[model samples]
Target chain A: MQGTTRTPSQPTTAYQPTDRTVPTRSPDRASYDKELVHSILDEGYVCHLGFVRDGAPVVLPTLYARVGDRLYVHGSTGSRPLRMTGAADPGLPVCLTVTHVDALVLARSAFHHSINYRSVVVHGSAYDVTDPQEKRTALDALVDHVVPGRSGDSRPADKKELAATAVIRLDLDEVSAKLRTGGVNDEPEDLALPHWAGLLPLRKGYEAPIADPGLAPGTGLPGYLSAL
Target chain B: MQGTTRTPSQPTTAYQPTDRTVPTRSPDRASYDKELVHSILDEGYVCHLGFVRDGAPVVLPTLYARVGDRLYVHGSTGSRPLRMTGAADPGLPVCLTVTHVDALVLARSAFHHSINYRSVVVHGSAYDVTDPQEKRTALDALVDHVVPGRSGDSRPADKKELAATAVIRLDLDEVSAKLRTGGVNDEPEDLALPHWAGLLPLRKGYEAPIADPGLAPGTGLPGYLSAL
Candidate 1:
């Protein structure tokens, strides 16, 4: 979206799509705008992490948080994938993708059936966050990512818990956001068909919060939970 | 979960986990239960399909449906990934995963912050459905998967439309369902912290469907939309 005249040392608002980030399908829907990619990533709570395992592809759904240009994901200390990511100096090549389905497009022609979705795909090598401070920040960002202000209200990770968790960081460079929006686009002839063609919107919403049964007698729902 | 005493030719209620389906982390949460796997797949509207391209794993989010033991996904015939899936004779090795986040598990310690989620992972090869009748059935199943009774209400696909779309069917052989439910599992010492630790449930619900502005005057809202 912008000129590549800026050196790698300088910070830029736009992402430069590489060969891997470029989409061969619906190319028109792909964008390298950093804001768009960040918005999609922020709206999503979980990401599908794809990596080559024993010559076969494996995808796992896990919680993720985007802080600045870096994406952070944490796992158990005993997790093989996380351990493998930090085993090598260059780290593990990974594809992290987050998607949000806005609506279901019911076109007149069945072939045109599609979903209104916003997705961000990041291609990079994931490195383990060995620094304790960075690890704590990443973990806090992850909790705050799910619900704003909740991190401040929640207790910070202790030494024992921090020692048990492993955090991996992926700096977003080859990033692209693909989005399909609006109503259905039916064929000229199919427009006159009797079938109803439009969008059936989908939304993920927060419901009433349930407090732990072991809560102190006087403890009440936090203000942030009420707002959510 | 049931014993796998039935023959391959006969239907079985339980799924047998191989080396691939077993989880390296949180192995206790993983199950080889067919009913649980099906339930997780059925509840999700989108799935992340991972495949290898240029020796790198790429994950794409797309619509999918589960019928019997077969999972069906369709895309544009011109799509590069979809095209490569059918270009090979034996089909393409894929890891299809569906996840549903039931609640946000907030623990007193940030490291224990996790999600109550149900996810199903199916590892197998996907083959293109060539038969016209089978393709139609698969397409219908995909449509109904989004909204029950939708395929019956909507017009079926025509010959030309079917020709333009490529349907890939993946048989569910190596399937595993992983789920984390209930409240936060915080450390006993951390329970005394001032932070509020509980669950924030998330729900996906349908709003009142809006009719197309270009709809015929007498055309009314579908009954299915009302139920939704």
Candidate 2:
């Protein structure tokens, strides 16, 4: 995994007594360190964004890109949560999470079997990003996150397009990264059961690019996409 | 590829004004058909669960199983949103969504580039599954959803486990599905650019299962697992 840091470590916000969040397996699973958090976030491009709108909870699957300590999410300005954020008391309370299931863990007994994975959950408020420069930078990061050099290659979002889109920023203040990997942990007694158990790994990658029919006769694959 | 149903059909719930939440999509981009909605949901296993806790929105990535017209989700009974359902007001409102990215639509101009995907969004009120029989059936559906025949292979959830776990039920109602698939639609002007544009196909599937090292003699793969 690629690991890089762009900011100095800062103190995390204090935990309030009123917070009702209850984490499972706190001792073995909790991780709040900054590097660990960013690494997981950087590796993921798609995230499941959860927020409550109109007193009802809503989850949206969307694309996200990280820049420094802030994560940027973009969507149509007409989205419910985005519109609601523009006129709200507390803004939108959101839990944004990214997960990658590394492998499946098959145990001798069904109860003990589980999957090995890496995931990060962020709990905080998401406010709309209004500054044009910041929004432009965030948008560039979004483009580059998927294909490194494309931000400069293609025409940037025009004034009208920018106006039609909505961008939101959430600081990575309260977050946790949980991971599990390796084979199953079967009980000694259950090990003798006549059940076959082990991991069935999961892998995700890109295949050959299929050129669109409209492409020019001489165009070839870009280095960045070929590398992917 | 599986065009199980082509015509549009509505689910059991009537389309109320509130359910028509995001009307901003281009006319060709939105879908309100039941077959389109169910097909998207049935093909997806993981869903983004969004809820509110202490007035803040939280989104979590978790496993979900769909049984007939209902969706099943469970976690520790101590979790905030799960517990919130038992408390006072108009029950907890939730939006459960599932998404599958089919291909990357790489346009000549980056601004026109987009992803081809199938997504289903369900809007409704959620309540705890209080009926014991229903809960058991939902749990079995969950187990079966993960691994088709594992529910029969493994020991079912005992009373103690059931007491400690909390499961919530949300019927499939007021739902919508959106899809975009196929090659990039490059603008005529940008076709002359030297950058390559094409669709990068994405897929997910299982690899061979590795038997647990601790299994005893005669413990071969189960018929159901092998079938998968």
Candidate 3:
């Protein structure tokens, strides 16, 4: 009701889903909302990047960041996925997915068991980020992604380090976010059955910081990390 | 070291590394040991399933279980990824990856900043498991994978529920595990820099279980969940 209603003045950035971004099954769960997609991507630290290599699908976990309508991912310039995006080429085709498991839905009947999760899938080609200014900004966004405000707290990369790192940017086109929320969806007949049914929520957190072995004693933990 | 050395007479069930399974970027971080690979798989609850759809890459998040040398993934028979396997052929060619982000390695230099993670990449075709018995076992394994002893606690799937679920399994034949552990690996010259650098560990845990709003009053919370 209230949550579903959107005001005209509100800047809604819903994505435009292409045939590939649309869900073939459970179409009701798919969302083309830009705000939802960006929120899901921002909350997640790492994403699974799938790309075709020699006609076979290859998926790898890599860090990513969402800045406005664009997503940036970086790796060692020599990394296979990064190297696949050649400068002169049209860029590498990729499917990047980020998922957060909110809870485990335990249904009375095994058939209805599922997870309460939020996931975003992006379909696009990743172009090599060549400009010096854009590359620096992308790299900073990545650091702040893992831990917000981290880039400001830490030192920036030098010119030599920048040369060794490669950043790839993918526009948030043909994107969709799918999710399942609330309690277990058990069958009508099974509701009266004896089996227990509920949700076991999962949470990710940061533990007490273990300073580097070589960390100078006077060097205290930064405020940003300590708060986490 | 002794851990790296293999003794004779032990069953060598290590996965064979094909051209694609090998890490092209950091080959030193890859391992083909069976024990190591299984350990990493067992530690993760979810996996990224990648496959080609209409000549484009699509990646989805799904639950999976490792039973012996095989990995089983199930979804609603109507799900797109599951339905694609039923196409007029043996099955679908898939890339399944399980990753555990252990810690964030904050290096003094941005280029060396990385996450200490353990990930397994399995490249092969997934065959539809139509056998009722195997399907039942796979489903049970999937439930147990989330929470140990959960399969025994919950009700088993009835015939009707079984008909609605589809299970596909991929062999751990062409699998390889890659990992980066310990603290940050900063450049030797940057080591003397004043910036702070170390490991920031990330942990996942279960929160308080919330009972279904409609749960019967007399039904008690299970001991297993309470313990967690």
* TM per candidate: 0.92, 0.86, 0.92
lDDT by residue for model 3 (A156-183), tens: 8878779989999999988888888777
lDDT of 1 by residue, A31-144 (tens): 787887899999888999999888888999999999999999998888877988878698898889999988887766666677788999998889999998899889889989
| Candidate 2 off by > 4 Å | A1-27, A86-91, A108-110, A186-188, B1-7, B10-22, B86-90
Tens digit of per-residue lDDT, candidate 2, span B130-188: 89999888777776676777777665566776887688888876676767766766667
Off by over 4 Å in 3: A1-12, B1-11
**lDDT scores for all predictions?**
0.82, 0.71, 0.82
Clash count list over all predictions: 0, 6, 1
What is the Cα-based lDDT of residue B99 in candidate 2? Answer: 85
lDDT of model 1, residue B217:
49
Interface RMSD, one decimal, each candidate: 1.6, 2.1, 1.7
What global local distance difference test value does model 2 have? Answer: 0.71
**Which residues of candidate 1, in runs, are more than 4 Å off?**
A1-12, B1-11
- Model 1: which residue pairs collide? none
True contacts kept of each: 0.61, 0.71, 0.63
Candidate 1 vs 2: which has more TM-score = 1
Q: Which is the winner by DockQ between candidate 1 and candidate 2?
A: 1
Q: Write the per-residue lDDT of candidate 2 for residues A81-167, one digit (tens) a residue.
A: 678666665556788888877666666554554666777888878888889999899888887776678888777788877998888
How do the candidates score on chain B by TM-score?
A: 0.93, 0.87, 0.90
